[model samples]
Target: MRILAADIGGTNSRFAVFRVGPGPLEREGGLTLPSAGATDFISLLERVWAGLGAGPEDFDAAVLAVAGPVRGRTCHPPNISWGIDLERDWPGPTPCLLLNDFLAQAYACRTPAVAEARVIQPGTADPRGAMAVIGAGTGLGHCALLPLERGFTAVPSEGGHASFAFVGPEEGAYEEFLRKETGRPYAYGDLVVTGSGLSLLHRFHTGRDLTPIQVAAELRPDSPTLDWFARFYARACRNYALTVLATGGLYVSGGLAAKNPTVVDNDHFRAEFINSPAHAELLRNLPVLLNANENSGLYGAALFGQRALEHATGLEA
Candidate 1:
């Protein structure tokens, strides 16, 4: 079946075409465009379609994994001014589906046929246990997959917006700093573990006001931003894993993890992740993997669309 999938983020959107069969998915190609180039969601879709020289009707089904909370069929990413209404805004009659981008990443983990993902921590992978995913990109996103009779089911979450917990005196001071900057009583995990968050932390840790790009370029073993960001992310991951009881595995994806893998591959990250006082042993036993393929989101959307299409066909028959 012909399928179209789009992974839409705050800063960019990637589109891909696929043909699914009994074996595996065959990808045609993909296009990436700056999301802010358009003023509205529909216009962005139009531009993507025109650039591909195809109409929405060309696809059998479509799925859009968006970087925001999806309530029913509508989504409004906090960073973007445009809102998406799946029911009203679809450009064609193709059966369309909307999913939180991290939910798509979770689906990618359960995809039966996918490239062998990199295992950052080689703790045993339990197929029967729950799987979790945490990705730090433009923002932090978290999701889980529950094992089912056949495979797994994606459970979308807004855990990224959960209150940020200060694990120590240093983090406590950082919390006060953020409160003073935003005039808020509390901070969210997204504010401390994202691309923008790294920039903010860099400024606070080193008294250097560098842009995100500059910070990324400067990140290394000796960089204070890298050390702090890695530990902060590890702490967040440990908390979320405990909350979800993710014994299956916890996979990390997104631009930040993908770009600077060394941040997660060091002793700092491992120490912080396994720092839980009572459950340190349990944390150490759980696997931590990386979704190294940046296109995993696109592939995941295709998998979702393919499943929906097949289910619809079975119902019709």
Candidate 2:
């Protein structure tokens, strides 16, 4: 089957064409485009279609992994100006599935596509247990996969929007500073653990506003901004693991984590991640992995598309 898959995050969107069936899933062509220039997903699709020289009619199925809370067939990504409705904006008559981007990544866990996913923390991986995936990008995105009889079931979450938990005096002080800076009572995890949040943290530490890109260029060995950023990310991961009881593993994906792996490579990162107090040991025993492959989302969308196509045709298992 010819399947088109798109992984739409808050910052960028990726498009790919895949051929899946009784053989290995294959990608025919793919492209990455910035989501900022366009006002809506249809416009973005036009650009992709023009670039690929193939329109929606060329594909038998399509799946979109959107960076937002997917309600039914629609999505309103936080940083992007546009929202997507599958029924209203889908390109063709073939079935289309809209899912939270991270949920799609969770689905990719079922494929050998993520076989190279890096294991940062070595621990027991319980095949039957639930697994968690979290990533920081235009915003923090999280999801979980519960092991089922035949495969795993992906569960989408807005855990990134949950209240940020300040664990230390420095974090508490930073929280106060954030409140004063944003005029908000509480810091949301997305605001303190993403690329934008990293930039904001850099501003808080250096009193100079710099985008994540600029900050990356000037980050020093003693950069408190990155230190705090790593801690917050670790804490967020820890919290999510606890929330979902992800004994199978915890996989971190997203532009932020994938780009700056050092954030989770140091001693402080592991210390923060395994610090669950009462259940610290339990947390310690769970594997912590990072989605090394950037295209996991697209691969996942293809997998989902294949399933959706089968279901719609009454051929699904």
Candidate 3:
């Protein structure tokens, strides 16, 4: 079946056409466009399909993953300006599925299409346990894959917006800064661990305004910004792992870590990730992996599309 998959994050939107059935899933064509330029998803989708030289009629199914909570057929992504309502905006007579972006990442675990994920923590993993997926990009995302009777079920979360835990005098100061910077009652995970958070952290240390890319590019040997970001990133991962009891594994899948792996691939991150006072041993035994493939989202969306198609036809076992 022809599946048109779209992975829409806060910063960038990626679209691809996949042939998912009977054989290996295949990609025909795709495009990545900046989500900043457009005011709506359908218009940007028009440009994306146009760039691929194919329109909606060419595909039998579509799966759209956006970085926000999905309500029925509509979603208003937190980071992006525009929201999408498949019921109102989708064109042509085709099947379309809406999903939270992190939920799509959850479905991506162990899929052959996005198999080259890197290993950060090589701990023992329970094959039947639940798996967690977290990533930092335009924002922070959290989700999990719970092992079920026959297969796995993807659970979406909006925990990134929840209050972030801060400890110690140093982190307490940072929390105050986060509150002042974000003007929120409490510092949330998305604001503390996202790309903008990196920039804000850098600004806190250096008192200079620099883009996330610039900060990453000008890293010194002992850059405090990277160090703190790594610690927080690890803390976020560690918390999510414990919350899900992700004995199967914990996969970090996001553009931020994918682009600058050093954030999650260092001693600082390692120390913080396994630093549970009561359950350190339990946390230490779970594998920590990173999906560096930016297109893994698209792969996941297509995989989900295939699954949905099968279920609709009562072919799912």
TM-scores of all predicted structures: 0.95, 0.95, 0.97
Better of 1 and 3 by lDDT: 3
Residue 62 in model 3: lDDT: 83
Which of candidates 2 and 3 is the stronger one according to lDDT? Answer: 3
Q: Which candidate is the best by lDDT?
A: 3
Best by TM-score: 3
Mark the regions of model 2 whose C-alpha exceeds 4 Å error after superposition.
313-317
Q: State the lDDT at 88 in candidate 3.
A: 90
Across 1-317, the per-residue lDDT of candidate 1 in tens digits comes to: 88889999987899999998776788998799998997999999889888889988998888889999998788998767798997788876777888899888888875742366777788987889998899888889899999989967888888888898886798788889888866767888788888888888988887888877788888879887788888989988999899989999899888888887876877789999999879999999999987777788898888888788778962122
Model 2: lowest-lDDT 10 consecutive positions: 308-317
Residue-wise C-alpha lDDT for candidate 2, range 31-103, written one tens digit per residue = 9999997878889988989989988888887788998998888899987899998778876566677788998
Alpha-carbon deviation at 308 in model 3, angstroms = 0.8
Worst window of 10 by summed lDDT in candidate 1: 308-317
- Clashing pairs for predicted structure model 2, backbone only: none
Clashing pairs for model 1 are: none
Worst 10 residues of 3 by lDDT: 308-317
